[model samples]
Target: MLKPILKLLALCAFCWAFFASADVLTVRQDAPERYVVKKGDTLWDISALYLSEPWRWPQLWRMNPQIDNPHLIFPGDVLKLVYGPDGRPMLVRDNRVVRLSPRTRVTDTRPDAVTTLPLAMIRPFLTHDKLMTAEQLNGQPYILGASSNVKNATEGHILYARGELEPGKGYAIYRRGKAYIDPETKDELGHELNLVATSRAFRAGNAANNEPASLQVMDARREIRQGDVVLPSIDGEALPAYFHMSRPELAVEGLIIDTTSNLREFSKWDIVIINRGTNEQLQPGNMLNIVRPSPTVVDGNDGKPVYLEDSSRYQRLARNFGHEQITMPREMVGHLMVFKVADRASYAIVTDTFRPVRVGDHIISP
Candidate 1:
């Protein structure tokens, strides 16, 4: 059911570029020499057994050109860690189908595979309208004046929209989630848009005649309201359950602006928004390391706060000022991969979390 991912036209090339690794990665000391693929075994699962940093699977997996795409990954396949001619570690006798197969694709040989994360964890975010800025929402088709005279309407309610609507077509109702900003630069990234409901056009509107369209709400998570943005209905069929893991073409250093659930203890499988995106040459499947920033602590010995930076300056004035800021090391708190990228923001899910991801967390090379 996974087509060539053409649906992501904006990033089809970048998405497909995920088939290979850009760098040589490190392997875990306790990693097994061989692993057999099993049903329900994700790429992340298999990669974890071999690499210290599991997100670098692309590097170790760069062995066989065939297995790069990984959509064809199947159970019962044997994988062994063997060195290549260059004396670097790589998988041996592994059949990996990188995204692009220049030769004729032989569908008869491979098995269908799922993604690194559970589908339920990311299904809600697989839409085009997840990130919307105020400027982008301007003049967008919206609910005319609310579904009805009532304050809020639920399922089976009739709604009206003030924009061009095609007869028999469908549209989705969405509300803003959070105002995301760049943690480093303090620039507004964009607003997270949530799909509130979906409706079908029983009637169509004409811009020339200023005629409004009527729609019957088919589903509603909450209330559909006036001024709510109405966009093309999300096509469930177009969603890609399989996301090939790849490394970023460029160095990615940014901050976690927000979490999807806004929990202080951000755990695994949680969706998040970072401050990097297409502007930084990022694309879907690019892996990242969620670096937790160290807190500044006061220097107890001198009775002054230890300054992490300006050590020489502190050394010169320490006896006189009794104050120094101590810099802490950034820890590898979690791992994530970009699934969708907007102009200035991206949506990624935490693949693994050693600690809770918070706002302003560092995102560096994986």
Candidate 2:
């Protein structure tokens, strides 16, 4: 009798802790009982209607077995919120097929399901932008010269390249951008390859005979110049439209190394590259919180402290000359979701911003 009583107490404690952990999924008081999924509604937008923190959507979907895969929620489906037997909120989807006729009946319309984010915002990065290693960039075919010795060529111009080139094949022209270096260790990560133009090989180069290949520029976003790299057109991976939003299982942290627009400061929806990637156990759909390191303060003689932002160059250096300095607490500025991961770095778009973010800002697992 004593053993049975203890077992029941242990189970009760375990159940209590399990439900208590979900307190963060606070449902809004004005949340509707049921909502009709719309054509343009995103998973993030829909989740924000019911929970305060929309990033915690995986928790809400887990309680309800009806929503096996959140990505499959169609536009015409109906979402109904109901409580489970354990008194936890569950979001249930009603995707019943509507019959149009008895003999020739219509099934459920499975149109393009709503993605987690606006695909238009990230489609270009997914297709064009890429990171290349130093060796890879150096080995690719380069524009040796242009027909008629044109210094800068546009569309429909013939250019000659000297490398192993294939005839009748499409190639993407790229200009070398900045080199990504780890902020902490100062190790060279990779070089940013900016897509400039695209072309097709009119004639293959023969390295054995020292013959250069002929290429005709098909499309030009910018003027194609000599020394521009020519590589096979990047047919990027087939990534899913909807990303499974989740935190990293391991503690991961890094600094923002670069931005797509080359802006000094970035905010929501801006694409930025971080120093961490698959090497750091980061992957697509991992959300990280951005933290801005606090500036150091110098204590002056007049019973006041001057922040580094307000201090002069001389005053900032005076900290080494017996001036007391204090480092303030770091602040959380925003959150970013990793959309693409390379070997040593990853591309992430700012999902939420509470303050202005800059390069070198720390990104930690949420």
Candidate 3:
């Protein structure tokens, strides 16, 4: 009897230590008893309703066997709260399907079908913008002039460009902007691009010495000017394949290089590029946290190092020449999810911004 009791006590102590070492998933106090899935809803949006930390959705999923896969939930699926064998709250589906038999049915309603996310929100970004490396875009075809040499070219305009243009092939026009560099190593990663327009050559190709090829603007997002680059147009559906969300399997860290609008400060729904890429094991759907580094400061009382914000009191005491500056702790400003990935860089849109994100903001694993 004494031996059995000793073994039981040891097992209890081991279980306590293991549980304490892991994160405790916190549920919302006022979590809904049931949530009906909607067409425009995403996993992130639905998870937020029941979990305090929506990023830890995998934890909630483990407790519920009914919600085997999030991708299977349709628009009309009803998520009901249930208790697991362990007495923990679990989100289970109480699916209800209503079949419609119309006299002249023409289309498949697909009431049971589901989508990974709200495609409308990310559809614009799928084809419009891209970052290019020096070796990739250098010496490529470029717009040399516009009709009558105007500073800007709009729709229904003719543009002259020097390149080997096949008569029917379409080209995407891009305006190159600033070079995005790594904040830590200060290396040029890639050049920022603004897609201006796309056009197909109509007349003919121009030789190296002959007049440049003539093309008509088929679509215009902005001003297509002389000196803009002309590259092959990407298929509209290529990016949507990565729309399925998946957590990052590896740990990663980096900093924001720039934004789609070229703004210094970032806002909600802004597309931003981060320095990390596939080389760092980054994948599409990997969520990251945006953080601001703490400011460095000096102590007023003694010639010692201190980490604090610059205040009026500190300004008066800074006349002393020996005060040392120290860096303060990092603070989270927002959260971002990677929707696209390249070799050394990836593009992410700000999903939740507690504060406006800026260039050079640190990106850390969530």
Candidate 4:
């Protein structure tokens, strides 16, 4: 009986040791690292590049006070990864600052370096739709005369008009309409303005010719503009420019595959969406950081040694078994960002980890 009891105790000790070692491994694997700063970048964008999650950037950033304004990282800043004597990756950046010379560029005066588009040719591409009403048109501070001096106007008819203080010679016309709303919530979002027609002044009239001229409504409606705002229209779809703002771009190497909002919603094969798109100037072959939540304090009493309730009756035995049992806080797991954006809703694959990632997990730009 004594031998059997000793064997059982040994087995329990072995199990505890194994689990403790595993926990340490998990912590080390999740530790942060130092990252070098490059040009055309900001701290917000940098943080998203290295860490599992971008929001937790404050943690790694707090480690470096030399960063001063958080926006001061310039090109050629050397970031070192410091570790403890135990070889464990400790806090990132010790706030050491190293500056380097800037890169110079060569200018080319060749014709290949310059391209121009004629205004006449570009005008067609620059037009956009606007929505308006007839009443709103009459209320406009600018009006010279109606087509054929008519009191009423209909769609597709060019109105001889003058603008406020200036003769309306080359101004485009549009009609304002109802606001757009969300299909489900019916919440008003934005106005759906439509373009009525383009107007060209045949005769330049004096500003004093404010006879409350009627403007032509290109698209006919039951009633003309009642209360609508008029704004200049652009010609065609606009392309997104390079995002130089402190936004994260693919900086390092990694793949994204999963995402989660909470432990209950965690999945290994979950999908994630990136803000980058073709319109945003993103292309194939870019990498981004997959972020996970930073470790947080869950319960203070956790990890404390505890004795079994049944053993409490035996004061001496309970005292020998220790005061309480300790359990570590639960850690939330997630994926890293990988893969270039294909469209507005590009998909990424979660590559690593045993846990699920949450929504709002960010992919930092490299």
lDDT of 3 at 247: 59
Query: Weakest 10 consecutive residues, lDDT, candidate 3?
Result: 104-113
Best by lDDT: 2
Q: Which candidate comes out best when scored by TM-score? A: 2
Candidate 3: list runs displaced more than 4 Å.
1-30, 37-40, 56-77, 83-90, 95-121, 146-151, 202-211, 239-242, 247-250, 261-268, 297-326, 353-358
Residue-level lDDT of model 3, residues 222-245, one tens digit each, is 988889999888755474422444
* TM-score, one value per model: 0.74, 0.77, 0.71, 0.27
Better of 1 and 4 by lDDT: 1
* Candidate 2 TM-score over all chains jointly: 0.77
Candidate 1 lDDT at 284 equals 85
**Tens-digit lDDT string for candidate 1 (258-346):** 78786877877788888889989998888899897687554636554544453455464564565544667889898888988888999
Better of 2 and 3 by lDDT: 2
Q: How accurate is candidate 1 locally (lDDT)?
A: 0.75
Better of 2 and 4 by TM-score: 2
**Residue 315 error for model 2, in Å?**
9.4
lDDT per prediction? 0.75, 0.82, 0.75, 0.40
How many clashes show up in model 4? Answer: 51
Model 1 segments more than 4 A misplaced: 1-25, 38-40, 62-69, 75-78, 84-88, 92-114, 145-148, 154-156, 183-187, 207-210, 234-237, 241-244, 297-322
Mark the 10 consecutive residues where model 1 has the least summed lDDT: 106-115
Task: State model 2's lDDT.
Answer: 0.82
